[model samples]
Target chain A: MPTIVVDVMPKAELLDPQGKAVTGALNRLSSSRESGSGISEVRIGKRFELTVEGPVTEELRERVREIAADILSNSVIEDVVNIDFGDDAS
Target chain B: MTFRIGVVTFPGSLDERDAQRAIRLAGAEAVELWHGEHDLKGVDAIVLPGGFSYGDYLRAGAIAAVSPIMSEVIDAAGTGMPVLGICNGFQMLVEAHLLPGGLIRNAHQQFIRRDQGLRVENADTAWTNEFATGDEIIIPLKNGDGGYIADAETLKRVEGEGRVAFRYTGLNPNGSLNDIAGLTNERGNVVGLMPHPEHAVEAGFGPDTEVAMRSGVDGLRFFTSALRALAAV
Candidate 1:
């Protein structure tokens, strides 16, 4: 079995409040230490792991791409950042 | 003849009953539509009520948009069937591609609940026919991800075509672009808004107005507008 991973993130132009909050927290922690204040921003996203029982064919890859674009990520506010097939895929 | 409107209840939907009650109060028969079913029960209009459908996983209304019933809903909407999406329902409508743009987390990063004032931008839609263009009304709005966004081109088109159904007035509560609070498709058959009009349909249970507390029944006209749209058909 091969596992396909899909990563989805909010669009770059949009404001990510969750990411901003994390960034703020990181900055606060880094400011207390010398030479650790380089963190600037963070954008949170989602990762979906899909397991297929059989060989990973091009057809399956295409189908996964469609799913990623249409279902896994909403084009209006998010993007399909990456699709990775694990090392098991021959 | 009695008009039949269907209210869809996706898993985690919280406002279907109130929507049904609003429909009944508007002198229309309210039918319950399920997310996992393919039938719409021959409804004249459909409403996707507010709630955290699928617990807002993978984006609000994402999973529920492709549910079994939405296939029927998509087809029916194509044939000009009237559909109203309120609050989280608005998210589903955008996810389903029945309406344009998308709602994102509030700019202030907080859940907002308030009696929101809105100006009717387009009064020709099925759910807004009872209002005149520029009519101001107050509806209770509550949501975490209610900020509306779109590409610059889409915004231009939506504005040029006058598809914006409602605009926030007095104050923009969620930082929605251009103060857009609601929208309608080109044919005016579909409408989606982030406010909970169903919550404001009843006089004693709605927003407080100058005359009395919880006496604003402005939301009732949304259902009545549907009735009027159906009656004229």
Candidate 2:
């Protein structure tokens, strides 16, 4: 079984309200998006790990990317989900 | 016919009920779906609710994206069925490649939670048709890994095309590029946002009930929008 990890990223200028809310409270309300953080943009994403039994090869990687692209994502807003397939596992 | 929408539940999903409630509150039927199930139950729209699907074990919605139910979701979204992904659901959309970009950990390195302000950037999507452009809405936003990332070129394209659906207001909670709270595809049917809209569909129970009735039913519009879209079709 080969362990796999997948990551999802968002586009720029898409305000991550959750992310901004946190930055505002950081340092006990010292700075934030409201205070004019002067930060024009932010990015957000998630990581996934999967255990699979497969050979580690370019074909396998493409297959995994295809899985991430078609069955795993919405292709429009998301750029590309990176899949990390680990070495073959017993 | 009344619009029917499906709420997908992965093994570790936490917002299935919330999503169902939001759907029902919007005057649409809510269909419960499981990750292992391959049927859509004739839903007109689909909601990938927020939660720690697959225990967030594999990058939030990574595993759930490949679940049996997702096969149907892919099929439905392709035919122009309205699909909305919230928070973890948003992550799954990105992982599933239905949307662009990915979500990462906050730069502050912590699970952030709060009532969030959002400026509706695009009101044309099936899920957002009820809203108007630049409308400000408040919803509960909570997540650990909600930072959105994408290559520079992709970022430019998403913005240049006016695909951005929502932008954070008041504060940049996470280190997301351009403060993007949500986005829609070119056709404006599929939408993915990092906020927990499900949590705001109820009254005092939601984060932003100060303005409306105790129902805190503002979020219901998301579902109703889809229902109206289906009806128009």
- Per prediction, the TM-score for chain B is 0.99, 0.95
- TM-score of every model? 0.96, 0.75
lDDT of 1 by residue, A1-90 (tens): 788999999999988888988898898888879877687889999999999999888898899999999999999889999899775442
When summed lDDT is taken over every stretch of 10 residues in candidate 2 chain B, the lowest stretch is B208-217
Model 1 score (lDDT): 0.93
Docking class of 1: high
Candidate that scores best on lDDT: 1
Model 2 lDDT per residue over B104-157, tens place: 777567798988888999999998899999898887889987877777798899
Candidate 2 lDDT over A15-47, as tens digits, reads: 445455555556344454457645544445766
Q: Using TM-score as the measure, which candidate wins?
A: 1
TM-score of chain B of 2: 0.95
B101 in model 2: Cα distance from truth in Å? 0.7
Interface RMSD of each: 0.8, 7.8
